[model samples]
Target: MITDDTTVNGVRIGGAEAGSDQGARTIELPSGARAEVRKGYGRDLMRAQRATAGGDANAVVFALIAEVTRVDGRKIVYEDVLEMDLADVMALQAEVIDENFDRPPQRASQASSNQDSQSRS
Candidate 1:
């Protein structure tokens, strides 16, 4: 269960979900509903993969929401997410992508070093 101050992957998650801000871990919809999102792990990804076996991009997003998020601190299923309003659904999707896929920017020096190393190999 995620609380107001839960930290996932060393990033503290709190407040309403915002765009490109890594500190938010909660999704707030225009309808006043809220969901607490947790950082996804391998098992969660496996579950999402199984739920979205048809290769549907939208289904994959909903499946991940089902496997990794909680509404009012209770676990929700894929059907629940599907039943939500499009705005809410999209908000959840954005949060899920941020939680699972967003990465910190690589330093320019590191990028250059990697490129140099690759060229030498």
Candidate 2:
């Protein structure tokens, strides 16, 4: 998601969801540094993604949460964008941008899977 990190003129900020979630996420910042957030959320999902396929999933979990709250005192509402593929999230995120920005946001590519957008975070 191209997160509404487009802070409201100065109040800096920040899905995240608490259930079955997955895929690549883009958290737009005031700065141009590209942020891609990985790792799944939700108990059922955390176990399902099998983030390790076989390794230290706790570490992965820790890092993801760290990034979510790192920007000291930032208050954010989690916006969930469902689907496994990052590309899909990018496209949907673009649409979300369009809704927010008014003009059409760029879509990365065609979806590999046909599904409706789901917002959870």
Candidate 3:
């Protein structure tokens, strides 16, 4: 989990999830930087996984990075990660994904609890 004090490039990064919206988060990096990271709707991640299965390591890495990281209020794409030096930002991107990806939103848990109660009644 990313804490509010987790800093990359001197800026803090944090994690948040609300309702069933998985694609809502805030990412902060160095150099007066901040971004809104969100979960990809699984299509891109599936495509990336397929590429990896086909022996495309580069594709998978960039795909995962792009799927999770956003910058300047825009979704980062494979081309975007390719244009930049991986050494500079890969760790930060990976950290954001590791901390925030693939988790059920808070509302989903609540809804499940509600369903369980109704089922028991």
Candidate 4:
């Protein structure tokens, strides 16, 4: 039963404060079920990439999840698709990848700006 103000681990999802720390965001499905999304750590990403390269969808999905805060309230601290349907799993994967994809561009642009300033100095 996800409300508009749903939160996971005390962080609001779908709000301006979402993804504020540890890349946390709340993912609410139309079925009134919700899950928290977080960016995977380095090893998680590495494993996910490897699994993706090997065409193992299950492993890839598992690698992207950091926690499931809403599903069972069990504080599961890893990818566990046993209770999640395909839609939820896919959504989690997409959110994780999207969050990861967004960071590099900003960093690259910032680096470029720094280099430009140094050159001007």
Top TM-score: which candidate number?
1
Q: Tell me, what's the RMSD of every candidate?
A: 9.3, 18.6, 14.2, 10.8
Lowest-sum lDDT 10-residue window in model 3? 11-20
**Residue 16, candidate 2: how far off, in angstroms?**
20
| Separate clash counts for every candidate | 0, 7, 1, 0
How many clashing residue pairs are found in candidate 4?
A: 0
Off by over 4 Å in 4: 1-21, 46-58, 66-73, 77-79, 100-121
- In terms of lDDT, the best-performing candidate is 1
> Tens-digit lDDT track for model 4 on 1-121?
5453887665455433334356556767545567665554555465456646876766655644643233433334344555567787667667766654456443557889999999999
82 Cα displacement, candidate 4 (Å): 4.1
Candidate 3 total steric clashes: 1
Higher-TM-score candidate among 2 and 3?
3
- Candidate 4, run of 10 with poorest lDDT: 66-75
Candidate 3's C-alpha runs over 4 A off are 1-23, 49-54, 85-88, 102-121
lDDT of 1 by residue, 1-121 (tens): 5565576665445642223234337767777887877777666676688888998877887898887777776678899998989888888888888555669896679889999999999
Q: What is the C-alpha lDDT of each candidate?
A: 0.74, 0.36, 0.61, 0.56
- Ordered from best to worst lDDT, the candidate numbers read 1, 3, 4, 2
Ranking by TM-score: 1, 3, 4, 2
Q: Score every model by TM-score.
A: 0.62, 0.19, 0.48, 0.45
- How do the residues 1-121 of candidate 2 rate in per-residue lDDT, one tens digit apiece? 4444444444333323321134435555334334444333343234333533555554333333333321223422222222124553444344333332335666655552233332321
